[model samples]
Target: MAALTPDTVDIIDPDLYVRRGYPHDEWAVLRREAPIYRYERANTDPFWAITRHADIVNVSRQPELFHSIQRLFVTINEEGSPAPDEAILRQLLNMNPPEHGAYRAIVNRRFTPRGVQGLREQIDRITAEVLDGIVDRTECDFVTEVAARLPLAVIAEMFGIPRADWAMMFRLSNMMIGPGDAEYAGDETILETLQRARMEFFQYFSQLCEDRRQNPRDDLASVLANGLVNGAPLPIFELMSYFALLIIAGNETTRNATSGGLQAFIENPAQWARLKGDPSMAAGAAEEIVRWTSPVIQFTRKATADTNLCGVPIRAGDELALFYPSANRDEAVFDRPGVFDIGRNPNRHIAYGIGEHFCLGANLARLELQVMFRQLAERLESVESAGPLHRMRSNFVGGIKHMPIRYRMRPRA
Candidate 1:
C-alpha cells in the first residue's frame, strides 16, 4: 500500500465528532479507506485515528509502546500546543506502568465488585427518590431532572459532600469536558475555563480533605485523606486529581450514558418495547445502550517508540486516538453493526476502554444504569419525545445535553 498522507485519509474532524449528529456515516467511510488514519487540524496535534476494533485492542494492550502518559486529546489551543503541565499530567490515566500500577492499586479496592455491591441499597434508594420526584410530571428535561442529578447525588454520597453542590459541580465538570461547547464559553477561553474549574475543584477538595483529616468518615474521601500510599499519606495534589477524575468520570460520563441511552431508546421504539415487555432485558438493554452511545467516544495514547499498527508505520512521538465509537461499530466484531439490538450476545465493546487504564468506576456505572433502566421500565407507563434533543458540543464524552420527554407513570403494582 502507498504511504498514507493527511490529504488521502479523511482527517477526523473534532467539530463533527462534537456535534455527534451523524458520526457513524463518517466513521464508516474512514474505516474502509484508512483504518489507521492520520488526522491534522489547525489547532491540534496531528494524530493517527485508530478506527478498527483489532487495532484499538492492539494499541491499548501494549501501554509501554502506546503510552497514555502524554497528550490525552486531539485538540489544542490558539498556539497549537499539546499538554504542557507536569503537575496536571501525573494522574492515573496519564501515567505509565509501574507508577500507574501502584497508583491504581491504592483505590482499586473501592471499585471492586464487592465494594460497589455494598452500595446497592443506597443506589436503589437514590434511583427511587430521583424517579419519584419526576414520575408524575407530564414532561421534563431528562438530562437535568433525572440523568444529571442521579449520578451527581451518587458521587456526592461516595465523597460525603453536600447534595446541594451538585449544580456547581455539574457546571465545573461541564466546563472541564466541554472542549468547544458555547455554553461554557465566557470572556475566558476554553483553556481558561478548564484551568479555573481545576483550580476551583482543587480548592473545594482541599477544604474537604482538611475536614476528612480532622473528622474522617466512611467515604472514599476520608479513606484517601488518611490512607497511606507508598507509606505516606497521598499528596494533596494527587488526591485532588483523583477527586477531579471521580467527578468527571463518575458523574458526567454516567450522566451522559443514562441520557444517551434514553435518547437511543426513544429513537428506536421497537427496542424500547423489547426492554419494557421483559424487564429481564434491562441488563442487556443497558449494554446495548452503552454500545450504541459509546459515551467516552475517544481517548489518546502516545507512541513510546517507533511502532507499526495494523501495518501503518508510526514514529516515536506520534499520538494515537483510540476511537471507541468506531470500535463498537466495527463490522468485524458485530453482525449488522448499525442495528440497535438489546439481544446482542457476547458484546465485548470497548466503551469502558481496556487494560490498566480501564475505567475503575465501570461496575458502579453498570449497576447504576441497570437499576435506572429497570426502574424506568417499571415506573414509566408511556414515554415519548416532547421536543427536539440537544447534544453537547464535545468531541470526547459526547451525549444528549437536553432531551424533552413526555412521560406518564405506571400505576403502582
Candidate 2:
C-alpha cells in the first residue's frame, strides 16, 4: 500500500460521524491501509488513529512507554490545543501507574465481588421499580425513561448524593460526553458546558467531602472523603477529581451499555428469544452486548519515546487513539465479527479496555447488566419498537439517545 499521508487518511469530524451513524466500512478500510494513520483537523493537533486490535493492545500494555497522563482523548479546546485541566486529567483513567494503582487500590475494595454481591438485592429492587414505571406506560423512551435514569439513580445512591440533584448530575454527564452532539451544542459564550459541568461537579463533591469529614457514612462518597492514597489522606482537589471520575465513569458508561443492550436484543430477536428461553445466558448475553456496543470508543495514549507500532513509526509525544470498536470487531479475534451472538463464549473483547487501565468498575457494570437483563427478560411479556431510535452524537461514548419501545408487562409473582 502507498505510504499513508495526512491527506489520504480520513479526517473524521466527530459531529458528522455521530450524525451520519459511524459505519464500520470506513474503519475496515483504515484498519487495512493505515492502522496508525495521522488525522489532522484544521484547528486541532494531528493524532494517529490506531484501529487494529493488535496495535490497541500493544499501546495499552505499555503504560510506561505510552502514557495516559497527557490527555485521555483526541479532543481539543477552543485554543486548538489539549485542555489544560490536569486535575481533571489525573483521574483514574488518565493516571499512569504507581499513582494510578495507588488511588485505584483505595476504591477497589468497594467494587469487589463481595461488595457488589451485597448490592444484588438493592439493584433488583431498583430494576423492579424502573420496570414497574415502564410497564404502566404503553409507550416510552427507553433511554430517557428507563436505561438512563436507572444507572444514574443507582450511582447517586452509591455516592450518597441528594436525590434532588440526580437529574442535574445526569444532565452534566450528558454535556460532558455529548459535546460533539448537535443537541448538546450550546452558545460559545463563557466556558463549554463540559467545563461548566466539571466545575459544578467539583463544587458538589467538595460539599459532600466536608459533610463526610464531619459525619462519615458507609457510602462511596464517605470512603472517598476519608480514603488515603500513598499512606496519606487524599487532598481535597484529588478527592473531588476522584468523585468526578466515578460519577462519569460509573453513571454514563453503564447507561449507554444498558440502552445499547436493549437495542441489540431488539435488533436480534432470535438471540433475544434464545436469551429469554434460557435466562442463565444473561451473563454471557451482557458480555456480547458490551462487545457489540463498544462504548467508551477511543482513549488516547502519548508516546513517551519514539517507537514503531505494527510496522508504523510513532514519535515521542505523538498521540494515538486506540479505537475499541474496531478492536472488538477484529475479524481475526471474533468468529462472526459482525454478528451479535448472545452465547458467545470467551468474549475477551476490550470494551472495558485491557491491561493496566482496565476499568475499575468492570465487575459492578457486569453485575448491573446481568441483573437488569434478568429482570427485563423475566418481566417483559413483549417488547417492540414504538418509534425510530435516536443515537447520541458522540464519538467518545456512543449509544442510543432515545429509543421508543412499546412493551407488554408480565406481572411480578
Give all candidates' CA lDDT scores.
Answer: 0.80, 0.80
Question: What TM-score, over all chains together, does every model reach?
Answer: 0.93, 0.93
Candidate 2 lDDT at 360 equals 85
Q: Write the per-residue lDDT of candidate 2 for residues 5-24, one digit (tens) a residue.
A: 43554434565455665547
lDDT for position 181 in model 2: 59
**Candidate 2, RMSD to the unseen true structure:** 2.8
> Looking at candidate 2, what is the lDDT of residue 73?
66
What stretches of model 2 exceed 4 Å from their correct place?
1-11, 41-43, 76-89, 188-191
Superposed by TM-score, candidate 1 places the C-alpha of residue 289 at a distance from the truth, in angstroms, of 0.8
lDDT of 2: 0.80
Give the CA lDDT, 0 to 100, for residue 87 in model 1. Answer: 43
